[model samples]
Target: MTDDRPQGTFVLLDLDGTLVASAPGIVASLRHALHTLGRPAPAEATLDWVVGPPLRRSFETLLGEGGDVEAALALYRASYEAEGMFLSVPYPGIEDTLSALSEAGHRLFLCTAKPLPHARRIMAHLGLDAAFEGLYGATFDDRFDDKATLIAHILDERGLSARDGCMVGDREHDVLAARRNGMTALGVTWGYGGAAELAESGATRLCQSTGDLAGDVAALLRSETGTRAPVA
Candidate 1:
């Protein structure tokens, strides 16, 4: 089937929970870091939330105000770079979804809280390097920990207006980021964030599954006309 949709609709995709199941590696690295820092690790049940946010922030939360967040982060990176980074697995049907979107003429980019180097490694490991036109992420020093900053950077660097694009992610951060940047936000239920979180974050649409996602994105891209700032 020929896709008649217009090209250049930028689709910013979040990594970690949205693209791959990276909690196992992330949590494991956190645990290792905490252990090295002589701190107790949080229970495995509570670590799921750690996957989407900045690692230093997660360490700080677990270790309190006085925690050596830098040390913990360094230790975490040592282990993650060597082993944990490759432990992630893409969500089922993700590759097919990406391929479908690309074929439909949308320009895809990786917008994540993960550091650019690590994000690149993970993408390459999962064979997703070719799926995106560019990858934007936080610095190793945590300069751009928030999604809003990263999204804004992507928009500014790529010369894209919010109206010509949308952000797809599984968490409130993603929805809030897109909202902040005056772009459409599409929440995916298959990720760590539940439906309630996405709804409360004011997601423009909630995709129940990957199958639903491709159609919704294609429709949005086809229907979007020109640039306009998001409504307050």
Candidate 2:
């Protein structure tokens, strides 16, 4: 009883950890912000954990309970916007995957918890702005609290039905958002989230590598329609 899209279709994608790995720059910027504001930096190992969700929550986690969350958040933004975000870079092979998807007659859009400005900047920095027809994300006022809500907004903006599109990401948050919107959820293991997390998040399928995505996705969506043209 799973509803899926046709072979050549639009796919809403998550940014950080999914399409790119912006950890080094993000971690350094966050550390500088925390230090400047007299807060302890989150352990290095856990820095990338902050990439997937909204920045405010990442700041909150870094600040810990009873910490000056607001001040820390302000400092975090100052550093991140000024330079922290530029540290982000797209994962290798991503260009090919995106190009392949587009050339095959599928539309690509971005769906991320990252702020509109930051997401836009990162996309442009990575030469990815043109890869998508639409870039959907939250404003600075809202954080990455609810992926479902964001997905709903994206769907509304595009005048899309759940059966016409799919969601691709590397986190449980991404999968849950797709399911919440009744869209097909596809997970990638090369990003922050692993296979177990994706499965638990109710993803329709998993792509082990970035390259596996185009084919598996073609198959999954093709199966949905009971017929499909060659993806190439």
Candidate 3:
């Protein structure tokens, strides 16, 4: 049986804030952990910042220098794993968008700061696991929590060139990671980072809505692969 799907660009996607609106679960877990530790949580206005970056760093910022970041992290994982993990939903039109991208022959992989096991489970729970060819993320030890390191590892392991990939995400970390690896970075304005942060971080393009995501992605990836035929 010959498969006829056109070889698509390597699309590395961020999980939280990009593919899914996971802030409710993430923020609730963080707040629960802080409360358990008897620490003060951030105000509502600023809590969204914790959704994209590593939890350890966010805890450090919320807990101050002498605070027990490890303990807070542990507490957060407990709460998140218990119930907070399922508190999110795919952004409106995201499922259709994913189908469109995959149908267009774009190879999709989830690239996230989230721990791998949790990410996998979340994907399964959300019925989104089938859309991705792979899920790349941090380990429990925080070794790959840095998006740049994770992305670099992904490129090397997958035998993919930075030139042949586009990082689709919502945060500065996502943009900066792609830049460090010399890949094109596309930012989605619907996520937590908004337009300003993505632009400031040097994203190659910004997608203003999920309605336009497939077209935007196709255009960017098309430009990147100009003159080179899609791989078989």
Candidate 4:
């Protein structure tokens, strides 16, 4: 039940695909941006990959090398702020899993590629803000657009070490970032990134459902701290 490690464990969670199914809002906003820029929007099915990566990078992929990524992002934000952001909803059993993790004494933090302000708004909208001790995200100007940079920032700002933490997300970016920072990566298959992607990205563990996720997290915490979790 109690952690034996000198420093308690922490978890960095991704926002879009991991916690919230934000593809609807994100895709709509992307479409809005493309329309505003006089570009043809791609088919809806093709946009699933857009949910986990940085907005600028996604826009760049759609708009090409010479595309005005900033402009598209600006337009996307305008629409997203007005009508699309709240179009998202949390994944099934996400709140319960988060509560269980928090109750188990592990510190949780939001670390996402989305802009900080937007990430805050999304969490507040979902009433999940209280579940996290802190939220670390990319800047509006895309300064920390990649998962590695955001994770590094969180570690530096909190005076935490990767050895005492892990990253849970649905994308390869998250797994790669965690590895790059010397932390374990937990991949969830219920999100956008499928099992193959997680496996190829070197996820320390792959969770098939909320129950699986919670169990893995508990096991990892116990393994790291050399203590057993309390039976539920």
lDDT of 1 at 129: 76
Clashes of each: 0, 0, 0, 0
lDDT by residue (152-215, candidate 2, tens digit) is 8877878877776788999988987787777888899988888998888777888988788888
Model 2: runs farther than 4 Å from truth?
1-8, 143-145, 225-232
- Listed in order, each prediction's TM-score against the native is 0.93, 0.88, 0.92, 0.92
Choose the strongest candidate by lDDT.
Answer: 3
lDDT (tens digit, per residue) of candidate 4 on 1-232: 9654335778899998889999999999999899999999998888999998988888888999899998998999999999899998999999999998888777999999999999899899889999899998898877889888788889999988777778899999998888888788899998999999999988878888876776788676555542122111
Q: What CA RMSD would candidate 4 show?
A: 5.1
Residue-level lDDT of model 1, residues 106-221, one tens digit each, is 89999999999999999998999797999889999787789898888889888997887889999998988888888888899888888999999888788988777789886655
Error of 4 at 140 (Å): 1.2
Query: How much is the lDDT of residue 202 in candidate 1?
Result: 85
Cα error of candidate 4 at position 4, Å: 7.2
Residue 97 in model 3: lDDT: 90
Model 4 residue runs over 4 Å out of place are 1-7, 224-232
Looking at model 3, the pairs that clash are none
TM-score for candidate 2, residues paired by index: 0.88
Q: In candidate 3, what are the lDDT values of residues 1-232, reduced to their tens digit?
A: 9874446467999999988999998999999999999988776667998988998898888889999988988999999999999998999999999999888888889999999999999999999989999999999899899998998899888888777768999999999888888888899999999999999988889999888998888888767442222111
Candidate 3: deviation at residue 52, Å? 0.5
